[model samples]
Target: MLRSSVHDHTVSTVPTREPRYEKKGLKAHRQLAEVQALQEAGQLDEALKKARSFVAKNKKEPAGWRNLGRVLIDTRQWAEAKRALDRANALAPDNPSTLINLSLASYHLDQFEAARSFGQQATAIEPENPLALNNLGMALIKLDDFDNAALVLRRALSVRPDLAPALSNYGAALNRLGQFSEALDVLMAALKLNKSDPYTFVNIGNSLRFLGRDSNAIDMYNQALALDPGMKEGSVNICNVYNKNNLFDASFTISSELIEREPKYVKAHSVMADSLIGLGRIDDAKAAAESVIAIEPASITAQALLVSLAARADDYDAADYLRAARRFSDLHDIYRPDVLANPADDAAKLRIGFIGGDFRRHPVGYFLKQLFTEYDRERFAFFIYHNAVEYDDLSDFFVENSAAFRNINNKLDRKVAQEIADDRLHILIDLAGYTKYTRLSALVHKPAPVQMTWLGYYASTGVSEVDYILADPYVVPDDCEAEFSEAVLRFPDSYLCFSEPDCDVPVRPAPVSENGMVTFGSFNNLNKVTDNVLALWARVLKATPGSRLMLKTMLLNRQDHRERITQRFAAEGIDLDRLILEGPSPREALLDAYNKVDIALDPFPYGGGTTSAEALWMGVPVLTKRGDRFLARMGGSIVSNVGLGDWVAEDDDDYVAKAAAFATDAAGLIDLKRGLRQRVLASPLFDGRNFARKFETLMTSAWDAYRARNDGEGR
Candidate 1:
């Protein structure tokens, strides 16, 4: 019912009361001690009554009100504590203890800036006050000033080494700075001081998660939950861990549990959407995200997920996706930093800023491996703005190779954008599109002279600030220009560039000759393999007698999903025996799946981009049909760029015919498979050097146009 721990002259608890003291000075002080003793004895109501009487009697002195404020703070009545503290401050203008109590009340009320200011005033009056110093450091950490927090916290620890709250706050600051190991060490020290602190365990879990120790992080989360079952942060964090582990069902279950308990927990709703997306339920994920937006219209988390769902839709509309995207972007306007120089600097050396979350081993990183490493150093100075949640070898490669790499991962989006603007980048490229954990909002500031979206997203970002979407002539044709917010900036050859993977596993020949049956496979995400795409694949299988269709994805592993997929195929007259379903595999094993597929089936309305590139590189010919928008036409662009025009079918009828024809002709399959990798290597699609040159030239052209448009405008 009450929380207080006595520690002699150290002033562990402050007891606030009214002016009812009959005696002055010494007797009034004795009355304050009596109130604190009553509180410590767990008689909070009796203590509060006595404090009120004392305050009512001794209205001339601030001590009665000070003691009352302290007792209110102990009861967690933050607003009431502030009222008492304000009275105490009015009576005793420079009392250090009253100032400290005022700061404590503000801290409990979540008024961090006010807390810091009061703590500063207290410290100035009594420079040796460890309590004030620790309070100020805690407020600094809350404000995300990790460096200043550490400094202030160190000063507090110097005065009182065993302060558990200071240690915990400092550790949290270290975790935010990405110093996980040191954070863990400091957190352990805090745990030693106060083993029952559930929040310390949550901070420990966060550090462990960031350090890639997922199992340990989960263990720490459990420890926190065991101590405090109602801890919202612990519940949400463990759910996030499950989502990251691809245990979507578990994540959804936990989030649902949280929702049932506290329906207004919008963060849980955002996590639920991520779980739905991972489960291959794009429509359900979209609904979940929309619900969060309904609750919190400006929620960036939900807005980004909504955009991701639109981008991943079976019937993706670039115009529709753009409109959805601007809803998120327009929520806050980012002012152009005053430091932005005149257009006179447009003629200066190229300074490029590439911002995104996937500067790690994700799809965006896999695609940019060649460019980040080989983009001509003398011509372009890179400022890689990495907003990463995790790290891998590719992350290091980009950071090490770039002229300057700033990890603005934990920084606010607008502030991070201003940092980019301060870099004076001539070309700012958003590699993350509308995907999760993106800086598309930052681009709204127009940080650089030339802003473009490329590689990461296939569709147009609705923001008018984005100048162009890098494309090949085949990808964004003249007819598709009106659907896009950005102008189509096409390359002479292809936009789908490739570099040799770190693993150059030898390519095997077509599976048709040995197996006696041509196998059609699509290793793309199951969400992309819509019902219509499945029906077409079924048609191809029925037309080509004795052929098998091998489908592999993370979803295929789930028994429920596997059965659903089987039933869906059976409804189309395709036997379960003819369908070979597979699930998640190791990287090398996934590449080996290409050896089993004679022809790769590119899923439509949302076809493959990286999957198609990988299929061709692994010596499997991908048959793709042209479609309306950028996402649908990725396969067409990839295949046509590698000089496989015959493989690009015109319609659904033509698609089935091509698959059947290609299956029957084993000789042609073998010939195409054998020569495919080399053809890709020689073509513009896989030419890294040529790709670098052309991309640089294109960037230069964009810069020149920016200069021409704003010749006199210094923006």
Candidate 2:
């Protein structure tokens, strides 16, 4: 085998040693070419290794270390790059390129101070270098030296107009400084230069969202997601669009989906709670709100939702809700002082702030419509803080006369507080007590120093912060003073003084149906129709065998709910066919439905307010049984005030007797109906100016008392 392998020639290989100068020259040329080739190919890792090898072999070559640092930057080995670049600078102390590389590496590692020093050195060496200027600007931005960042970025852009990164970074600086419109233009230009930049699009959206172009912001989010679907921020932003538009169900669906992926996401749960509340799923809303509180104990959303839930349930455990509310109030605090001198001060000219959600066609509005119309603008300034979304004709009058009217519909409590403080209000009244959309948090924040909860809510807020709750002798009996958060302030005849609008309908002289079955009507919310109320109503129907009970409410608008109500009445030994369940009707139709009812049956525990008034206006007397609480006596109060004391029953037994007697006394009933409208029209209950004057007197008294209590404190 050895003889056959003669061609292998293992005997003849001699190691060649060349002259030192020639070998060194050849090696130097080869190393330089390798470094240049790797750098040109953008193989920074391989290039760094090659350059480092060359530096090790030839320690005197500054170019080798400089190239190595540049390669380190490409690999983002910023610290190592800084060291190598520093070595190159030391070896050749005046090289602008070496100084620039050192600055770049420092900037990449977020060492803005060191980066700025090296950048200054580079610019000092070659003051007009566009790359160096751009690098300096970016470092300034990273350091949050936004003013300086703007100056340097503009300089760089002036030197090199096509620099996309510098333009985009400059736009962000403008955005940080609140020049959103200009920033939008610059960011848009950056996008035009480089269309696929996700950050630029996100920044553009951020500016748009800030400007309240929420739909445009949503479109921008969609565009960003289209470019990169994994943008979680964009997804959250899209959900916010649903929130802003009041498409709460859509928002909830998106939030629920997000929760599946991130179960403890606090913002998602918060949005879910809001959406659920909008959908009227209060129990589910409570659960979602609890989840938010569990995740973030100090979250404002959680605290506010819990407050709302307690208010809605009519169970104010005040401790937590009150404390949080006080904290918020302290932050947004405002106080009122008499601006005019004592002699010049006109009690008639004090500023009045009205806070509520129902300036629309609601119970609170019905009572105040005439008062606001006759508020005597020459004597007082008025401000309204409306919390609800819906509005009607009466709302326009409030808007027109009020010195300032703020629709604080979607604003947070803090923002609302700030606005109130800005207004420098004198007297603040809470027209909405515990009703839905009543921002108790804003009241807690103490936007105004003198605050009173009045009118709309019957029960005490159970928060000691309130100064008073407006009532009358009938609604606030002297014995029940302990039930109030504020001192009980009573009007002369009634707490609710109706302001009669020109909506007059002529009284129908004849009976609704002498031939038709004797019909009883109740127009109230389903929530007010408690079990006991239903039982009493059932007794009224049973007492008159042929009489039909017309149970009417908004809830009955839904077929399923209507069926449920019918079934419930049937279970109470009422003939289902005889129970005429009617849905919500328009105002005119509601009045028309009155003619169909021979008598009105009021709800127990929570009697009808506006409905009772409406029935009286239509000349239909209501029979109401007095209960212990204010809510239970609204009907009795209205009936008594309208000069129909006989119609105001004293108890369950009296209610049955009164209703049957009214049914049997057709001639007396006819006389009562024919003359009842005139009686109400003349009564103090419908006198708007009289009520407003009384209300003003009460407010002046409250202010006087408030000032007297704190006179020595120099408030």
Candidate 3:
């Protein structure tokens, strides 16, 4: 989810000065004073009239023009205020007060660069002006220069320690810098000075959300709404929190009302799309994303949603998915740094850097933990750039095992790329392609000589600067090379190396023997369970008499989500009595739940990665259909690598046949379950040491290729 910045159009106080023209400007100065009095008294219409009359009478007077600009700013007429402020600036070129007002006007008009320039000019004139520093800090936040904004806001507070606006903006900068706890302290201080400021409450909410205190964040947002009921930022923030927590029903309710109240609110549409996606309404989600694109053509959120939706659809098309990814890269192609020279010393340990946001207890973290522990430090030095807000014990493992670990969360893309380039890394690998909190834009800067994407994503990144994508023969075959923008670097065995689960849950016998009925289960994400997957499962259930299918995922915790799943199965002619729907559980419990299943069913087009590996570890044999693309073939790779090639089928009919054939032989199922774990442990899927050796060789070969190319170009 994207975070929002706070912007307020509170006009700065104009400085009092004597009239330049002793006799001719006396009337103009008196009229401007009366206008200021009316504005201070909240009679904006009368104040605007008096200010315009003053400016009309003494058009050449800078004080008259400045008074008119202040009145326009108070009335929230940003464009006219900018024009009046520009006139005042032309008359009195170095007036700090006029420049400050111009900065506020430009910020309100969405001219961030112009706002920054005006603020810079004001601060250049008066270095210790609190108002100038405050406005400049706000403009810097708008431009994603969080570090510099923090310094400027601190200087503002140093000049006037009790300045509420400066404190609020400083808290905002701290939140963007990933210092959430410090931001809370700064925001609370701002609240004590001015309890009625809605923007301060919103900033506090942002800090709470980033700190993983969702309920507290919601309460803060409610406080903001209570103070100003029509505040769009607070409402959108509440919707975002609900979506992140998988409370799609609540999110849908709020976002739908927001859209009705304001038709062209782009953030409302984006959150509405996320709600629809969580609710498993794919078509509605696509339409909502399209609505966002129509309203704001260059919205990166909308383009990324289209790409994810295409990859997860029932009728998955490789060409359409690639096009969507390409469109995202095109829109995100804002930074392109000059290529740096390759490393001069060939014998130095290759500096390999991995950049991603999933350094916590995520699938990417699990897979990477084993590789980090097994990497040969003699030939390589690992640098970790973590871009996530949350961290756990697994995150600590990454930091302890790496030579250098840098926390780059919430930093600007160009800044991150520059830091990576400064590290002098020989190779930089991206673990996140287009997922949330991705730094793919940083990769566009070509910070390293060899850049590759692996593991976290399942398809082409569509970034031309990315040199390659790590895959295996089963997932990305020879014929599908044209589908990717990068070269396909195929691994000899499996593309993924499974990290054994931390907990130990003893494998139990097949549930078929105890219940006298087979239970086929799938614990993949509900978003991957398209109508096609459901229909195929329905066919398998029909083929085997008295067989049941179990569906488990985090989304099933919601009553609406459970009902949606039940309704979809009923539409496929599957009875409710034969279905087992479950929600999330603890790690050990989740692993133990597989004890009740005889066969694990994998979803199509986007098959399971970590989920499939877990099912095998629990001794449940997975039956997956072979597919034509990388995402669709993940299950095939896992199943084939673990010496269970017979469990993989060629097509839908073959899949049903295999499921029926496997379930009909009760004794055979029992025998397979008893030895499945040991079988997987002995196969290449569980051979982490060998996998690391192959990985090292592959990376060294890629570096050699990069050096060859650079030598040919005489770089």
Candidate 4:
């Protein structure tokens, strides 16, 4: 193969020429025109034959070789087209068309860098070449250089506003940058240019999904698939919609077909994992995620799925999976606030900051409530930066106690970071990981100097700048330190210290003396009740014959959802008559329902958190299996911290046995329930002041280390 001119930086131009009037030149030009018309007519084979004949007769004409390359490109023979384009460019070093053909050939072969180089040369030679600019932008998109991709496409649009390719790809760049609304507008403009473009429809679907218009997005995806039945992205997105709508059966069927057709399709596998999780196939979900990891070892989506699956499976290796997910993806950077703070400030109290959207009756809020109530105002100033629009009554507590409270609901991450920095916070902590409603990308903008991740997540953040994860020895052992992106900073006792609501329910002195039926209850979210959980619960109910299990959760609020859950359990040999499901009741009424439950049966894998705490607070003993991840070990953590280790089971068998034991030993169970509330109240978990002191100590130590290193810089 001939090599093109080695002018890497400079653009190649088409040499200016007038038609030569000689007979041979006239005949050659006529043959080239005939071949070009054939190529445009989609008769690539005929075009190639005619081009080869012209090349044989007119061996010195570069146009003949360029025409052959264009034909090869049409046939998707990229490697052969590259060779022909190379020879064409070598023969006529300044041919813009030859350079452009080479760029297209490289693009088809997935050689984005080479394609970009040739595209740059083509655009430089013909500054108004919209095709060349569009090519450059597409290459940049593949390379994840969205900023420059946007710049190049904008230039392309400037030259040709109706450039469909430019608009479509520019919209994709916008999507990558998280500008979904703008991406939708750009994609709509592209659709107007060519209504038949299936790619634009897919892009529009992506933007709409991100903007929370999932139903409309599903319609767009369906339309794209209808337009081009073989579109893989649309197929995967359609499956995603099914999972989002809680239609796991449909999602699993579609994803199974997708896996068979494209075994290495990572996104499809991730979707399959979610569908499997919903179907109550924990092992299958784990396998699907493992398949994704096999294909792309560093895939963030795969690792996240694996973490959730492992947690839900109640697997002993769940914590390791969480660590692996963290290692595989850099979730977010921990800001080092001390670096950005003024030195020689030892005399003043340290300013601590909490950044997250979950300060409103959420799990993060439940854990953080104690922090605010117990924090020593004289020694430290608290700064709470809320990023969410909604706030519950609990937010009032954070506001009343915090030294500086800022509602940054509508502000972007950069602006939020500036506000935190302006407060001169010594330690900035991230409560939200990569979970939903989390603004993690804001930390990527480097808002603070010392940012760390704590509660509200169980996986690695995949962020490089994030400093550490506040944990306990039980949560992150010393040997497992290497698995985390951030350093594992072990705290004393428990990582999370629970705060008992001052308005605790009055404990009934007498437990129900009735014994004919055993009441089983769980107050966790409906999403946590996987198929495996229902199956296990069914087994327990079967073992304890004549006993009815009462399942209380908010999802049971809808009669249809209750029936669906009931039907699923019935299929596992649990009769609908044996299962009593209840909707969400008022707080006090819900607490009173604990009297009806002899023993609280916790869900496996992704176990209970606030629900478990509330159950114990209601003087109900919860039977739970110890798990590796936070979601799995909620009961274990709360029970152990509250001095109820006997209630914490080590495995599934143990959990079942404990439940049965509680049923057999009615008197003992009643006694345990009566003293449960008192035990929890007496434990250190309820001592908010002590927990706050420990949290403060950890933050100050980290800040002091940052300051000492900076202080010794001149020495």
Mark the regions of model 3 whose C-alpha exceeds 4 Å error after superposition: 1-24, 332-334, 340-347, 712-715
Evaluation by lDDT, superior candidate among 2 and 4: 4
* Candidate order by decreasing lDDT: 3, 1, 4, 2
Measured on C-alpha atoms, candidate 1 has an lDDT of 0.78
Candidate 4 global TM-score: 0.72
lDDT of 2 by residue, 1-715 (tens): 0000000000000111111211246778677667767877878678777888888988776767777777777776789888887887787786777777777788766587887887788778767776677677667655546677788779878987776666777776676555678978987887888777555666677667656788898788778778877655566666666655556667778888888878877767777776666555667877887898788776554655564464443333435444544543343234222121121133347677889888877778878787787777776788899876456787887788788878776455566777876776666788866455566557666666677877777666654456777888888789877665568888878788776545556667525346535678888767557567777788888887688878776657667667767787888988788888888777777777777777888876667888888888888888887766666667777888988878888888888888887787667777778888889988878877787888888877876776688673212
**TM-score, ranked from best to worst:** 3, 1, 4, 2
lDDT-wise, the better of 3 and 4 is 3
Any runs in candidate 2 off by more than 4 Å, and if so which? Answer: 1-348, 501-504, 509-513, 649-654, 712-715
What does candidate 4's lDDT look like per residue over 187-228, in tens digits?
889888877767778788877876878889889888887897
Worst 10 residues of 1 by lDDT: 1-10
lDDT of 1 by residue, 574-661 (tens): 9999988999888778887888999999988778877888889999989999887777788888888888889999899999999999
| TM-score (C-alpha) between model 1 and the true structure | 0.87
Clashes of 2: 1
Q: Tell how far residue 473 is off in model 3, in angstroms.
A: 0.5
Best candidate according to TM-score: 3
Model 1: how large is the Cα RMSD against the reference? 5.6
Each prediction's Cα lDDT score? 0.78, 0.69, 0.85, 0.72
Q: Which of 2 and 4 is ahead in TM-score?
A: 4
Worst 10 residues of 4 by lDDT: 1-10
lDDT of 3 at 689: 85
